[model samples]
Target: MATLRLYHAPISTCSQKVRLGLAEKELEFESVTLDLLAGDQHAPAYRKLNPDGVVPTLVDGDTVLTESTLINEFLDEAYPEPKLSPDGARERHAMRLWTHLVDAQLHPACRVVTSAIAMRPAQQRLDREQVLSDFAKVPDPALREMRISVFEHGVESPYFERALRSYVDVLETLESALSSNQSDYLVGSRLSLADLALVPYVLRLDHLGYSHLWQNERRPHLTAWYERLHLRSAYDAAIRAWEVAPAVEGMHAAGSAVHSRVDEILGRA
Candidate 1:
């Protein structure tokens, strides 16, 4: 087998999912970490691997994969010892639905929320004109414009409230699922691609000091499910080990500062 080479960014949610998948499979790979805030993804050389200029371009011999969800599915198919997917056809469909939701909805919401809360402070530290110049290079026009809006407006951006609501909806859905499911994992009795796909987003909220979304009696089932997953060694190796301390601290501070406002927006206040 040719060695796997992964081009990823440490703090990126997409990158985190792929890393978790690799860790679950116990596969070793050459890691090329990109500094996304520095526009490393925009470089011509990196763009060749991923035309979208996104983190997590996985290379396995001649097979190069782009989308993180697809990369994870490929990994499971290629190496299926302790399978990351479910056995039953219905369970498989359910798992795919979760991954699709992450790709189609949760991911966009996460980007906006992270930009509005965790990343805005760091972006502000850079020169304003340079920030605009860098964002202008983003391959997706809608994403580029959204980034500019979030950067300029932070939590005040119109996109922020909508994004935050998306998260609230996801949390409500998760709470309901966990409450109804027979297993601690999402789709079945064991960890599957579905749980791995959603964990990073949940972790992002926790990192941003938004654990109130699941903590306490508010969402007991979701809270317990998350705690159970957090105890796994793969979670520590893949996610916690890659966190940059300074960035985590900054996000916590920023999130804490806006807790009341976030609550207000969610009608919790």
Candidate 2:
């Protein structure tokens, strides 16, 4: 019952994740929109709130929470009516690991693709192929090898191509995780943070005009699961209500953790 405010950007998937989390809990909070495209987060006033200059700087009472995964976890635990995360320690850890992978690896690669593809003006395009070639630098040999076999699946190269690979990998893995012949949700056959984290990505896939790629013959189970989530009233309002221009292109839609968990998850020095 504390005063709550959210700093969000239309194009930010991370912010959207928090929005979905809050909505699922049925918590009513005020929303404040920030202009990420215009560099508003860099202003002196906002900098004091979040030095990182990110879209989702959540203000809960007097506490300011940055990071999408943390913020969403706080809402889940704080509200706790319709849980967004699971109960057991093992389930929680699994969810945390998946969230970290999506937030760290997939989201950044998606940004690289988006900035190169559509985030830039047509004439201003920075040559995505060159950008992708440059991506080979700070490289993880494992990701690079995965990136190659991924490209063989039939997608063009460049930054966005890597995004496509990551996207497909996520969807396929998720589909296989669902119950063999009967299940709707992602983890343990119930709605969890895993599903919520993924919904925004799926939403962006449609926004980017790649809806067909997720259709029947392509990823039937994944498509079905996404559609099922779309029917939830909370999902419809909290997550889908906002209008997004896509902070970047081809693949773009992208978290934080709770105060209590920070010391546990990140571990205090």
Candidate 3:
């Protein structure tokens, strides 16, 4: 068996999910931390591993994988003990639905929200031309435009309101699922890829000082589910242990400053 090596950034939501998956499986791997803000992902050598210049790239010897969702599924398939995928085809399908939702909707929304809120302050401090240059380097035209818009406009960015609404819809969906389901975890009786996949996105909201989205009786079931997941040992090992305190603090401060704006956009104000 070849050793696994993971290239990731401490605060990236995708990286956190992969770490959570690895932790749940009790898998050990070599960690290569990337400094995303410093444009480390764009370096020529790192780009060879992932042309997308994204973090959370997993290398299992000759097999190299990109995309956090696929990497986690690979981990479960390769290490079947304490399986992350639920039993039964129906349950597995349900789990895949959640992961798909994350990949298709939540992930893009998360990037916009994080950039418009948590990352805006930092980006504001940098040289404007340099920021534009970095945004231009993003491979996807739409994504590059999103970065530039959020950097320039913060909560006022056209993307921000839609991103906030996407989160609201997701939280509502989570609340309904957790409230109706007999099991504590999503999809099945045990924690599955579904729960692991969504945890980091929820945690991102918490880290950004946006826990109000689910907390305070707003979405009690979602709040309870989130609390339960937070207590898991894997969360501490994979997320809390690797957290960069300063960056988190900055996010908190930046996010806190925009509470009114967020509330206004969400119609809570």
Q: Write the per-residue lDDT of candidate 3 for residues 8-66, one digit (tens) a residue.
A: 99989999999999999888999999988878888889888998988989999998999
lDDT of 1 by residue, 62-111 (tens): 88899999999999999997799999999999999999999988999999
Query: What is the descending lDDT order?
Result: 1, 3, 2
lDDT of each candidate versus the true structure: 0.92, 0.65, 0.91
Specify the poorest-scoring 10-residue window by lDDT in model 2. Answer: 253-262
lDDT of 3: 0.91
Model 1's lDDT to the true fold?
0.92
Collision pairs in model 1? none
* Candidate 3: segments with Cα more than 4 A from true spot: none
Instruction: List the candidates' TM-scores in order.
Output: 0.98, 0.74, 0.98
Question: Mind giving the per-residue lDDT tens digits that candidate 2 earns over 130-157?
Answer: 4345334323665445443333322234
Model 3 misses residue 192 by how many Å? 0.4
Give the Cα RMSD of candidate 2: 11.3
